[model samples]
Target: MNASSDGSTTLFVLLGRIADRTLDDATRREAVLVEATLRDSIRAKALDVPDIAQAARAARERGVTVHLLDDGGLGPYETAVADEIRGAIVGHLRCATSGSITVRILPAGRPTLAAVVVQSGDHTERYEFPAPTGEQAHTLFHGLRRGVGRSHS
Candidate 1:
């Protein structure tokens, strides 16, 4: 992370929650509350990581460009937001799985703030898909599709 002459800290949190899966509900709710507190703390400067997805959305709405980094799958937490954030303030959204560890690099900006929302419940689990074989229906689709196939017993 790099600091500017101005007094603003670059904050980045790694969010790793998989899509369409239930996470620690308690933790998620706590995140909302923590996010509010964080906003208050960083009112004088820059802060990051109060709520995972919501914080980014808020930042974007406030003319702060939001850059999201996700593989669309579960992955490890790595500090990569520094390259994208150029504004006076920087923030991050990070999530972790059972065996993964999150890491962040502290830059020269003073009063760097970070908050974590941890829930006590079942973590997200990965799913697998079976490859299609033989002749299957083929068509040109222009929109989203949701399909659930049943397995033979």
Candidate 2:
């Protein structure tokens, strides 16, 4: 996906085939919580705010449901961006199956995030990406997608 005109916004485009079915009830509920938390965090940001509201609206328009998790206390802005990226990734995974994607932003040594995708029949895949800053978070977002694509191919 191309970066936004100002270059601060990273457009997450899902190139994979979207599934025909909707997310399960529990998963759908979780997605709502994540979106709400993300929206709150974005509003609390002091600077470098991304257009999360716009992206979320577009995702809803496309019927994309997203779910996410974050460890408390990691920089709000970074965590918000990571959460946003994770939500998009989860939405992409939903297109393939009733699978679930859980994104965790760890409060470890450095800003690190992990995405665990669990497919139907119990198959699972995990990806780790660095999210030290907004730009790095964007790179991590794309890297995860590219890595997943390569694995499936």
Candidate 3:
């Protein structure tokens, strides 16, 4: 999507306009998708996406957040982890119930897909990684599961 230093600022501006008191619900959804695409581009870095586990650790101290645009492109492992992530942030935000959690699947030259869930307010909390196999993947899954979770044990 980075064809020219990348992404149109207009899309970002439109996200702000989602609050226009006159816009119908349908229009607002479109505006959010546009906004998410650009916001993901800006946040993903495209070249060097951060490791999701480490980022999740940091996010655990803050909060987890995403609006899923997965579209079934993510592999099984990513899909499972993404499911966990989707579960983690449910009902956690007061932003628009629909577009509050913005998850952008970014393609990097790395081995695994990156999923960054963002809820922009006073700050943005996001994390993603190329989910590898074995113990590492298990750890990644757990981190995402707990990114916004409070353990009862």
Candidate 4:
């Protein structure tokens, strides 16, 4: 992101450095918040300004979603926590033939988020959970497969 560009399609690299005056602390990391600005409009990027008040005002005016997750800065957390998430999913995937699984970190929080899309022939099942460590994934995939453990007389 160029720090000196004002043209269209210019990228802006901003830090979450809006200070907290109420706490009266002068720490750098503590002052930063877990937030980012999304500029859908041409003039929606005033958060990069030198003044904190103006930056906050622009954020308040332009912000629509309750949660804004920019997890680019969370690489360490993602790497360290992905294996546990994988462990939670491996057992349930025994029956899945064609499917897709997505594992994601919670960004500024603990407990990873995972979504799995299982395909058993034409039927598909999708689920979102905090890294399923149980039969949740198994049930979704197993049920989609017909006549698995049936008693035939």
In candidate 2, clashing pairs total 1
Instruction: For candidate 4, write residues 47-80 as lDDT tens digits.
Output: 1222322223233333312121223223343333
Best to worst by TM-score, what's the order?
A: 2, 3, 4, 1
Off by over 4 Å in 4: 1-82, 98-112, 131-153
Candidate ranking (lDDT, best to worst):
3, 2, 4, 1
Off by over 4 Å in 2: 1-67, 72-96, 108-111, 131-153
TM-score of each: 0.19, 0.37, 0.36, 0.26
* Candidate-wise lDDT, in order: 0.27, 0.42, 0.44, 0.31
- RMSD over all Cα atoms, model 2: 12.0
Which ten residues in a row are the worst by lDDT in model 1? 136-145
- The digit string of per-residue lDDT tens for model 2 on 7-124 reads 2222111111114344567545545544444543543232112443334334444444434454542455465554555455444443543444444445545545444443445565
Clashing pairs in 4: none
- What range of 10 consecutive residues in model 4 has the weakest lDDT sum? 40-49
TM-score of 1: 0.19
